[model samples]
Structures are given as structure tokens and as C-alpha cells.
Target chain A: MAIREPIRTGGRSARVQQSIHRAVCELLATQPRESLTVPLIASHAGVTPSTIYRRWGDLPTLLADVSLERLRPDTAPADTGSLHGDLLAWAEQYVDELGSEPGRAMVRDFINSGAACQCSNLLRGQLQHITERALQRGEQAPAADLLVDQLAAPMVYRVVFSEQLPSTAQLKVWVARALAR
Target chain B: MAIREPIRTGGRSARVQQSIHRAVCELLATQPRESLTVPLIASHAGVTPSTIYRRWGDLPTLLADVSLERLRPDTAPADTGSLHGDLLAWAEQYVDELGSEPGRAMVRDFINSGAACQCSNLLRGQLQHITERALQRGEQAPAADLLVDQLAAPMVYRVVFSEQLPSTAQLKVWVARALAR
Candidate 1:
């Protein structure tokens, strides 16, 4: 499934890829991930199944690609002058994005299919940035791993298992407790 | 898919149900949950799909039943004389069970399929039992919900996303930290 030529990012092929990405997200918003198939995505995207296969190879790979492309460059958490504010802002955004119904479907698919994704690593790096800033200011920052374990993990567990999205206030309280130690 | 008579706790029917439950777990041990179908389970269990549908209603219900039954009565944590001891014992056991490869697969299935489960709630109740013991002793026990969010959630998130099972020692440290304040 290799392309004979280098597919330029500004080419027609790139435009098709963009359309396919949009189609996948749209389908995921209303449908269960397991029920999605290549043919279904191709039909929705106005491309041939062969085009999907040639570009993405498989559903899991395509799903990962779509997830990566969905993260815009400016979407990383902004520094909010304090570790507490930074943690709260990041957690709110993280919960809002990943705890949304559509995001849940994407996660369910990625996890159930046992697909390898860089999203976790990406998220960890983003978190570390905030912790680093706090350390520079001589504020006792909780370890990035600890924050992930105590704060991020519970929110994710609830989303996947109970389908309950935590409110910002609920998340802020948990973050405060984590930082208290 | 109604049963004509009450499901007998005794007789050939009981034995058949047991066999079906065993078959589901065996299949889960070796295969992906989404790939598992009623007919496949029936063939593996030496029963018919209608038998499964009639008795269990669907795969999610059957999966939940198998999970519930597979949890032996003695699997719950015992009172280990102190909150720290009890929490460690339970977290280690919980991680060893759910963080194992087969257990992760089962969780992935139950989660991805949007199945309702008593496992999470059951786990919370068990944790509360230990906290309740602490309360009776006039020891300050963190809220059961807080304990779960800080301790259990992180362990589960790691297992599901990183596929790395935390060591008993690591779990103890986290549990200690969570209980510190």
C-alpha cells in the first residue's frame, strides 16, 4: 500500500486526507467505534476504500492518525502563572476533550483494538511542562507521574467505565488534593 | 428471550450455565472481546446461540456474568489490622488481577462495548469496608471515594494505557502518599 510518489502536504492527496479525517471524526461522534469499517469511512469521505488502504493501511492505524491530526499545534495547555491554575486549566481541557462522547468513542476504539498510540506520551510531555515551571518558581510541584496517577487516571477510569464526565469543580478539587501532598 | 420456567439453582441447567461461564472466560483469555460473537461462544461452549441468547440475553450481559462469577468469594480484601496494611493488600491483589494481560483484555472488552458492570462499584464497597474499620478504630481514614481516585484510578489507567502493571511496592508507596493527608 505504498504511494509511488511523495504526497505533498498541499497536494490534492493531502486535501483527500483532510476530508477523510473529518469524515472519521464525524462518524465517531454518532456511532460506536467497533461498528466502523473502512468501506463506511470511504463512503462518508467520498473516497474509495483503496485510497484509505493505500494511505492508512488499517483501521487502527487510521484511527491513530486521525487522533494525532486532531491535536492542533495550539491545543497544548497554556501556562496560568501558578501550578494550581495550570493544573486546573489543563485538567478541564483534557476532561472536556477526552470526556466528550465523541472522544470516548475514539478512546474505546483505540483501547479495545489494542492499537498503539502516542497520545499518552504526548499528554505526559504537556503535563511535565507545567510541573517544570512550578519547580523553577520554587513551588513544591507534585511529580508529573503522581499528578497523572492521582488526577488524570481517575478521570479517565470514570469516563471509560462509568461514562461519567467530571465537572471542572470536581477536577479542581482532586488536583488540589494531589498537590497538597 | 424469556425462560419458560425459573432458572433452577439445582439440576442439569445449573451445570450447563457453569460450562457456559467457563467457556466465556476461556475464550476471553485467548481472543479479543469485540471479535467474540454469540455463535462463536456457543460453538466453543458446546451449546447453541439461542441457548446463550435465551439465558444471557446478549454478550455484554454474559461477559458481565462471567466476570462476576469468576471473582471467587474469597477474592475480596481481608481486614489486615490497619488501614495501610489493608489498602496495600487490596491494591496489590487488585492490580495483580486486573493489570494482568488477560484481565486487561477483559476490561478492554467490557469498557469498549459500553457494558454496565458491578465490578467498579463492588470494588468501592470493599474499599469502604476497610475505611469503615478505620473509622470505628478512631483512625482518620481518607474518604473511600478519594482513596479510589488517587490509588485505584492511577493503577487502572496505567494498566489500560501503558500496559505496565505496577509492582506491589509501587502501589504501596502510592497508597501511602494518598493516605498521608
Candidate 2:
């Protein structure tokens, strides 16, 4: 089936668009994952349920989009000469941001909501790419990319699962382990 | 207020009787994370909701016990003599089991349910102990423990977040990477 994209308008769109997205997102961050319903979100957003259903078919997919939108990683590669340095800097930035209120809320939302977001899948790809680049620069032994995937992804999971901001020490440990393997 | 202890029964003083425990576990394995409610579980178990509530306080706590009861890691430390062999065995056993059908279902339940299950907190602790043991087995590097947490934990998270099971090769890659680091 051909999917028709929603049309954008300057005046009408402006009037309703920001309010709709803001309403959806605000309710998302504030409400319990289970309590999140189209009607509830609309009520919270000050719009009708039709408006919400029109934009995002169901609550799980909408929540997935919102959650994914929040964790869009900084894609620019860090070429700071040393692999360890680049990795540490990236790890620090990643951990630092994830350790915040928004990060916690996002994690909590995933924990509470039964919906599994596609963000993790996307992040896995990104993590793999970055790990490859970092390894090449470091002149480390030819480590398999899949190995990097296994070695590096779990710390982020632990942080989210435990809802604790990992210290820099954890980042160091990750780098050390990844290189060692 | 002092936490009320479970009444002694079945010769063990376990609050949740063994039959009820098995029923609750079976529900978590088969039911969708969000669909796991008192009435659903009770019906599945051929028990009344009142009985379930009397034995267990609520859905979340009941769900936690359901998942937690079976996730205890094989505490038998691998004595393969080589750190690599020991870790490989642990990763294979741990990852395979974690990615197994029943394991995935319950955890998916835990994640989707917003971790309302009281046992979610305990599950996190269990993972830590398992990881700590793996790191402690390393011959030279003392901090492989940190490495394991930092590197491999995220991939496991990725698996839980996704509905698909991770392949053994993928798991091996993750463990291999952790070993190198």
C-alpha cells in the first residue's frame, strides 16, 4: 500500500503542529508508560484523540518514535589522534548525556512501557561503525567487528537498566576490555 | 514499619507457595509483558484473583518473582584453567540462556511492564554478580571486571530491547572483544 505523507502548511500547520508534538512529547516524559493512551495523550496535549491518532497510528509506535528522536547520537567522528582518547571522549559524552534527566526518563519509559523501541537497533549499528573507526586509528590487533559489538554495547544497557550514571572508570574499563579482546 | 514476613507454609515459610510460583512463572513465559495481570495469571493458574492477591501483593511483585525465580546464574565457576575458555563457556551459557525463549519472554515482560515487577531490582544485582565473577577469573588483568561491564552489557541490552534472539556467533564476538580489552 502506498503511504501518503501528511501535508505541511505554514499558518494552519504552525497553529496545530508544535502544540501536537509538544503535547505528545511532554505527556510521554511525564506520564507512566502504561497510562499512556491516545485519549490520555490528547487530553494532556489539549487536543482531541483524533488529532493524535491521525499523526501517529498507535501509542507504541509513537512512543518508539519519540524515544528514538531523543537518543539521536552525535554522529561526527572524533579524530583526536589517539583511539583511547577519542573513545574516552565519546564514551564520556555518551555516558554524560545518558546520565541526565531526559535519558533517565527515556530509559524509565522503555522499562515501564512494553514497547521495545527501534532506537537500540539503530544505536547498535552506530556503535559498530564508531568502534571500527576507533580501532583502525588505534592500530590495535585486527579485532572482529562483531566482537566490538558484543564488548561495547552492554555498559549503556546496564546504565539504563540500573538507571545509574556510570563513572568515567567504567568507560575506561570498556575501552581496556574492547582492546584486550 | 517492619516489613511483614511471609507466613510459614509448605515447610519453607515461603510467601508464595511452590505451585503458585510455578504458575506465575509459566504465565510470564507465555504471556505478553503488558498482558500479565492478576486476573489473567489467576485464570491461567486456575486460581482466584483474591487468592493471588492474598499470596502476592500485586502484579508487579508477582511478575518479578516469576522471572527472578529461574534467572539464577550457574554459580559453578568454570574451571577450564584458561581465562579464555572459562569466559567462552560462561558467555555461551549466559548469553544463550539470556537469549533463550523463556528468558527473553520474561525479560521482555520486565522491560515492557516498566519494570513494575519488584524483582527487577534483584535481577540487576544478579547480573552484576555474574559479571564480577567472570572478571575475577582473569589471570593478569585485574580490571577485566570493569571491562566486561563497560563493553558487553550493551549488546545484551540490545538483544532484550529487540524481539529477535542474538546468534551465538554474535555473542562470541562480544565475549571475544571483552577478552581482548
DockQ of each: 0.52, 0.34
Task: For candidate 1, please provide the TM-score of chain A on its own.
Answer: 0.74
**Per-model TM against the reference:** 0.80, 0.66
Which candidate ranks first by TM-score, i.e. highest? 1
Q: Grade the docking of candidate 2.
A: acceptable
| Model 1 clashing residue pairs (backbone) | none
lDDT of 1 by residue, A68-153 (tens): 55753465577788899999988888888887766776675567445423556667777788899899988889888888787888
Name the candidate that leads on DockQ. Answer: 1
Candidate 2 per-residue C-alpha lDDT over A57-84 given as tens digits, one digit per residue, 9 for 90 to 100: 6665556556655566556546677666
Q: After best superposition, candidate 2 residue B81: deviation in angstroms?
A: 6.9
Candidate 1: stretches off by over 4 Å: A1-19, A26-35, A43-61, A135-140, B1-19, B26-36, B44-47, B53-61, B72-75, B135-139
